[model samples]
Target: MVVRTEWRLRQQSPRFKPQRRQAVSLTSRWIIGLLTAVYLLWLLVRTVGQPDWLTQLPALVSELLRLVEIGWLATLLVLWGLVWWHERQEAGQRLPPLKLEELYNLHPADFERYVARLFRQKGYKAAVRGRSGDLGVDLVLTRQGGKRAIVQCKRYRNTIGPDIVRELYGTLIHEGVSHAFLVTTADISESARAWAQGKPMTLIDGPTLVAIARSLQLSPPSSPKAS
Candidate 1:
């Protein structure tokens, strides 16, 4: 009987990716909006009052106003589209089916390597932190537009507790990184959720891992391993 091997080189976990934060804060947006309004109002005043400088450029003033109006509308449309896209991405965190058996068969060291690959598949500058003294960080992920986020993978057979979450969050604060995550093939305790709340920490449980693996649709290894 042929035991069809069912492992794929899967990477990219929806759990590891953060829900995009507000790229533009409200205060900055308001400040820019106010300044634009003031400038436009001043321009209108100058044109209507026909100031000496304004009188010399009657045609140019009208053309500039028309261009400004068009530009303003275009800017609004772009901003709206960006916001819509961000929201859609945030809402698209659906879990998909995965070959759980294959993932379960991975050795602990292999699991770390696999997790690193997953982040890389998602376009992160990712690497395993090495076994020697990593300060509890297993993987480090970076991107051009995002701050470095550290990851810790756990291939445990049981649920974890709040202390694990606390440790990761503490490391995030101490290192001052932008984000932190804990990925495990197990559930977390209620106290764990309590600690992770309102923090830049993510706790990815087992089922979530399966979904990310499924989404990756990875290819199996080229050859069978020696027994």
Candidate 2:
């Protein structure tokens, strides 16, 4: 018998929070302005100290000032680049924030929507059949060149066992699908993983789901909705 239980998505790290709009911090603006003033003061001090060069030729003074301006501009550019690099590195280290829909509260039918959104973003034509009468298979996605797949979305917190894998294999044969995808927010049993090793089925666990969420850039659902 096939047992069905509700599964919740794993709790996400705060670092993965997504920003809805862009806004500059007051502190950052203040720091930038302060640094600009300091650079200008330094240039003035340096120009005043070089009396010998200034007295030699008035035209050379203009050239010297131009060079100083160029140097200051280059310095600002370099600083901006460094700041950008640092922010990007932090973003890389931080986890992408997930929405309510991405969580475990999603229904089995909702799995089809998530899968379609993910695969469609990758330039594939996918259809969601989650509401169909199939117990194990939730979706049927077809790619170009006559390739078709059967997919099962398990939103269970408990580890998937060999029986589930066996059931999918049976459905794959029954449906005559070339590939099968069994995805869940929880881990799969060793036996289940082993059972899928020599088969056409692909098993995706919790970690894999996070990776997919990051790759596809799916926005987290603000409110939990029934699948």
Candidate 3:
């Protein structure tokens, strides 16, 4: 039975290719636009014709306006739902499905480890600090016969503000590190970015993190990493 089904599917493969839907004719579009304009004009004329009705209909108009507001809100909700659904569909198409345990295992610490490994693979001697203490940094990376860099990793769900950047900058100065990097899976706020600008400190946000991961060929986390 399986063999027969396989044979049938193979035979039908060419017939099953999707075809593009035809575009609406220009005549149809013109008719739709004309009808919509006429209906709107008629409504305007009808509303103008009844002055007494209009005077009495303020309450009704208010109620209709409320209903229109509700309709607009519902339309916005539906559009947002559609956008979310499309994003989910695209994500599924672009990546392989992950298991729950695999997702659960993806932690900020794991990301730190991955980054360290990547740096090491690139011939930079790197280490992940288990705790944020007097070490004055999170990841210490040393380039061969080059400057030693200190990286501060901020895994936040929301935007990393200027406060964290300021702290790292202070630490960088205190430690006398040649270079400093503040990395996060989330974005840094405009103020935070501006604050770090021209300060001899590097700020790596979501896009930069993703780019680095791609460059290093690091696997995607099963679950979303904290920003």
Q: Which residue runs does candidate 1 get wrong by more than 4 Å?
A: 1-98, 218-227
Q: What is the C-alpha RMSD of each candidate to the true structure, in Å?
A: 14.6, 18.2, 20.4
**Model 3, C-alpha of 211: deviation from truth (Å):** 1.6
Q: Tens digits of per-residue lDDT for model 1 on 63-123? A: 9977987787677667656655754453333323334554555555666666765565555
Report the lDDT tens digits of candidate 3 across residue range 26-110: 2344554565566556557657674465456778786886587567556655655654564344333222222222212335455
Better of 2 and 3 by TM-score: 2
**Ranking, TM-score, top scorer first:** 1, 2, 3
| Deviation (Å) of 105 in candidate 3 | 7.1
Give lDDT: candidate 1, residue 207: 82
Give all TM-scores, in the order shown.
0.51, 0.51, 0.47
Local distance difference test, each candidate: 0.65, 0.64, 0.59
lDDT, model 2, position 158: 88
Model 2, clash count? 6
- lDDT for 16 in candidate 3 is 24
Backbone clashes in each candidate structure, one number apiece? Answer: 2, 6, 2
